[model samples]
Target: MSRLFGAEPAEEAPSFFLEAPRTEKALERGAAGDLRYGLASMQGWRAHMEDAHTACPQLPDRLARWAFFAVFDGHAGGTVARFCAAHLLEHVLAAEALPGADEEDAAPGAVAAALREAFLALDRRMQALSRAEGWEPAGSTAVAVLVSPRRLYFANLGDSRALLCRAAAAAFCTEEHKPGRPRERERIENAGGTVSQQRVNGSLAVSRALGDFDYKAVAWRGPTEQPVSPEPEVSELPRRPDEDEFLLLACDGVWDAFDAAGLCAFARSRLLLSGDPQEVCERVLDAGLYKGSRDNMTCILVCFPAAPGVSQEALQTECELDAYLERRVAGSYLRTGASRGAAGHPCRLKGSAWAGGREGRPGRIWPSRQASGQVAWSSLQGPFGFSRAIADSCQPAEELSPHTDYRPPRVPLGSIFLRSRRGGGQAPANNPPPRFLRPLSCQSCTRTCCRRKRVPAWWACSKAWPQSQIPASPRAEAWPASKSRAPLPPSPPREHPAVRQPPLILWEWPGLLLREA
Candidate 1:
């Protein structure tokens, strides 16, 4: 039955994927001297967010000349990641491994040693905390970098990554510590563990990380030689301010979607579009979701004095692209007949879904200003600056419904374009838009699935189509927006008669619904 409907085998599916992803992002931005940084994180398609980061533009007291940044990608649970983000810097500073205020001339090796000790120290502290708190078995991959005026010190314990961009390209990146790596595998085997299917003992995917006391139970061996060692690999590189562009740190969530060179180019192009580092980081997270990554995503982008700048030409080109999309959307409405879709059904293009609103309610969103018949486009504004004229002209007041049938603007498949303003050149064909452009409304009811990349869950419409293949009334009264983060009501379990009787099947076409006979 599963094969006939093309459902993924239950065993092969990821253990933590949700029916839909949460698209909201957490953004932070700051600047210090020639160093400016932006950080963005999203819980994309994961059951829980487990990614955390640290960014200190200036270290305290005598260490003010140095800047610290790191990303932690947690697995099994989020406790370790949050703990590391809050305390890793303090531990690093207290290690006294770095050059003193008077030792400005200390060799780069000193910095590397200091970072290594810091990672080990943090792991040791976490071990004690885990026992005290009685935490569930969990661990986190950590990748960090310390930047001084003269050099960079990189350290890592697992698969999280950091990259350095120079001359508009990827100059260097840290190596990932996967369990399958030759050296990593040898260590695991010596520690009485086996590597199978690229995982340690067919379990953990990474060879090193903080926490995971279960793997540190080798009483005869030292902590550093355990199956899953917490000791980090550290390296040092001389800084090249003349050619260096920026530094990027991210968890596997972002790396799973891009290679070092590809990500560098993508980040550079976004920087050209907007000099705001936070926006650039948001774009990276969005792109990662579009590329089908199923993890908690976090990214930190630190720009140097030589980073790319926004260009007038690129901005103009972007505006033109927006105009083109608007024209196409308008023409599509005209061709399909005003306020209707291609199949003669009333178009369900609910504009309110484009903005923040109640999580489980459809056609209800926060208003920037009260307008009797039309929603204010200002509140729904995105990076593209979609024109109000086009939206208003295309959608009549009567056409706004709780249920959304998202038909993307009829533009060419590869029509989207991006250019680097600094280089004054066009980028290669990449960054196709995600399938769904806005949150989806249930075709049978008013419930909302507030995600841009995945289909609405079956339960979103279950109240109306409880046990029938027939469609129910699609009309619903819009509710006033509320400021709340409350969880949506749980749907009936899969074994319930309503669900078991006739399985709800998600059709391949975006926003379309079908019921299995």
Candidate 2:
């Protein structure tokens, strides 16, 4: 039996027979455009509530279309989790790599990089606060989602997870970082830490977390080299309005009780019964509690524009109408002899009539041609109810443009440096530096680095050594000295001889450069 936060190990399992005088439940619900979202949390049988969550339908004013949601499961105490809930999203917004609302080159890889840095920044802030306030050995697992109109970016650390339900199934999920996993275990051991009985150093249960200060005590090692790292694994997927249903983020308490498929099925069934996302989240928490989850439970549900429960009947009717119009277009084209237009191109249903005449006041169908050459059917000007007949007969056509066929850029996994370590001394003359380390144009680096920190053109030492041999530290001296430059800060004290400084490496795509042991 492992102890928590330096607490003495118990010979027998601790009992939580005593229940709280009152249940602690929190709920939030909102909408953004066609999307709807809900969040719910319950303390369950636990003596104290240690779970926290966040929901934002729209980000800061600068990034209006973006939304964010997250769940944090705390162990040892709830302070860490609460802290993360309050600041994680803000940090993400502040990341230098994150794209703006209207940036044309906003690629998925850049968004993923921003997410990774956001998690690391949160961890760093917690660590710094813990040092000053003498906080307890507390930590939290986080799963967060950043939703844009066209894409969804996810970041995960520890056991909390983000899952996507699409086509009536769990289409995507973030992998949990557990100590028992082979790769996680290997990282722990390599960092001079141990995993015994599936617990980190026979204590912490997770391999990666937000604020476990004790596990991060190897001063000679970089942040990622600690027994528990805060670096989140980030991934992105294109949003499919036609097929994607909803996204769910939950703590281990919910996940421990239900697998991805089971939860998606349950949520979908509930959504059909009641179109309210808030009610669905409440039911999910209740289900986790009923299933006997041993820890505090938290869950957040985000419904895409196409998700169930939001006017499903109308959508179905629209689909049927679209099919009918397609058939009508084909039939009319054949009957009208496919007349040629002014430009000698095939005229698409230019003079077709659908039973009614142009003089009809209500319930009349009006045909229009989109720029893409697709035919659209709409109701003629009339009272609300009068248009229903024509609206049900024809569906609106989707607008298309040259950029409509754009797909999410496939970022090469190798391009996002998962782990970058500093080499000892200097590199050999024959070999070139990695692509990421190579000197990029100023504009490229500015766009890539975001706004948080300004990176130098050639991020290397001021000495004559090759750029490849430059130290991995972000604080490396700049090559040029401007007349207006401020004086350099004093160097910190040297480390103890017994503690060796490891090489610095970039970790998880293009975020957070860390030293490795």
Clashes of each: 0, 10
Clash tally for model 2: 10
lDDT (Cα, tens digit) per residue for candidate 1, span 67-181? 9999999989999999999999988998876787755677647888888888888888989888998998999999999998878888988888999999988999999898878
Please report the TM-score between candidate 1 and the true structure: 0.67
Weakest ten-residue segment in model 1 by summed lDDT: 388-397
**After best superposition, candidate 1 residue 28: deviation in angstroms?**
1.4
Query: How close to the true structure is residue 67 of candidate 1, measured as C-alpha lDDT?
Result: 93
Best by TM-score: 1
Q: List the residue pairs that clash in candidate 2.
A: 96-450, 96-451, 416-509, 418-508, 420-505, 420-506, 421-504, 421-505, 422-503, 422-504
Quote the RMSD, in angstroms, for model 2: 28.9
Per-residue error (Å), model 2, residue 439: 74
lDDT of each: 0.63, 0.59
